[model samples]
Structure formats: structure tokens, C-alpha cells
Target: MKNTEVLEERITAQGCTEHLSAVEDAIYVIGGKWKLKIIIVLQENGNIRFNELQRNIPGISARVLSNELKDLELNGFVKRVVHAEQTPVVVEYISTDYSRTLQPVIMALSNWGKTHKRNIREDAF
Candidate 1:
């Protein structure tokens, strides 16, 4: 049998636990309500400062945003740059190269979400 076939058999025989584990790992990093929102915002607008992101997100508190930003930074999905040139200093967050790799996945999820919402609306009527 082909190598692909053998791997497929292993996955199938193992109840697809490996696939589930991979998905769970992704969720652990980006599962929160706000992580994807932050990612989407950064993707759409490029780099942004803390206050700017809070303003764009709407309904997110300073504390929560801070925590999420830290988490994203910790996970290597975002980079924080601090500019000390100004008196008060400037801080901005931008997506890492790794995060950019997720753009297609994000866009696909977004489109699927829109369709799901429409389906719900139609079903409700």
C-alpha cells in the first residue's frame, strides 16, 4: 500500500484523534471571542496602536484587550513594537509572518460565518 494509504488507515483506525488534536491546538491559541476579531482588524488595517485597536473593536475593555494582546504576542501570532522616539512613546501591534499565513483560513471562516448567519435568518422567518 502507498504511504498515504497507510497514514490514512492509521488516522482512521485511531479514531482521528490526531486531527482533533491539531484542531484543539489551533483553538487553544485563537479560540477566545476576541482573538480572531483582533486578528481580523489587524489584517484589515495593518499595524495599529492599543487605543486604536480598542476603538475599532468596540465593546472591548482596556483590561481584556491588554490580556488578549499579550496572549497573541506570547503565541507568536502578533508582534509588539515600541517606539521610544516620542516623549510618551508609541506602541503598535502587527501580525507576524506566521499570522499572515492564516489569512486564507480567516477569510474562509468569515465567508462561512456570513452564510451561516443568513441561513439562520432565513430559518427564523
Candidate 2:
């Protein structure tokens, strides 16, 4: 089917719950181990290539990173740009306009994590 048809189908299917469910859906998009980390890294550093992402986020396997990046790109939160060059062509990942919707979600989670971390640290101390 065409892109417009798909979008219209989705809009028709989703109702008042769009806003509320969208927030939940956002979690599903960025909830993974590497996804949130990738977002945080990108938020700080701007666009990044595949290898750079894997390097910045230690302990994430190549396969896992590839899958996660693909998922992010598919979900409209991240975009993949392919540079048509010679060998070792550059591929960069950047956030999309739709991704701007994620900022408040990320900020809320950041605040929550900070508070939770402080509480845990204080308890340990």
C-alpha cells in the first residue's frame, strides 16, 4: 500500500487515546537498553555514525546495535543517512522531526532517574 493510505488507516484507527497511547508508545521505542543510551549520546553529540554509536555505548554487541538502530529508524525516532561514497561509505543516524516529541519524555525520565539515583546513593552511604 501507499504511504498516505497507511497513515490514514492509522489515524482512523487511533482515537482520543492517541496522545496518551503515544506516550506509552514512545517508551516502547526508547525503552531498550541501548536505545535510551543512544538517544542521550545523540542529544549531546548530534548526528553519529554506526561505529561511533557502538563505541560510545560500551558492552552493546554489534548485532544488537544494528538491530536497535534499525528499529529506531523504522519507528521514526531516528533517521539513517547513507552517503554514497567509496569503500567504507559513511552512514549517519540523526533524530527526525517526529523525534522532537520525545524530548519532554526524555527530560521527565532523566529527572526521575536522577532522583532515584540520588535516593539509592544516599541509602548506600
In model 2, the worst 10-residue window by lDDT is 1-10
- What does candidate 2's lDDT look like per residue over 40-117, in tens digits? 777666799888888999999999988987887888878888888857788888877777777887898889799789
Q: Write the per-residue lDDT of candidate 1 for residues 1-125, one digit (tens) a residue.
A: 12342443444745678788889999999998899999889888888999999999989999999999999999988899999998799999998888888889898898979978988898899
Clashing pairs in 2: none
Against the correct fold, how does model 2 do in TM-score? Answer: 0.72
Per TM-score, the best of the predicted structures is: 1
- Which stretches of model 1 miss by more than 4 angstroms? 1-11
C-alpha local distance difference test of each model: 0.89, 0.80
How close to the true structure is residue 7 of candidate 2, measured as C-alpha lDDT? 48
Residue 33, candidate 2: how far off, in angstroms? 1.1
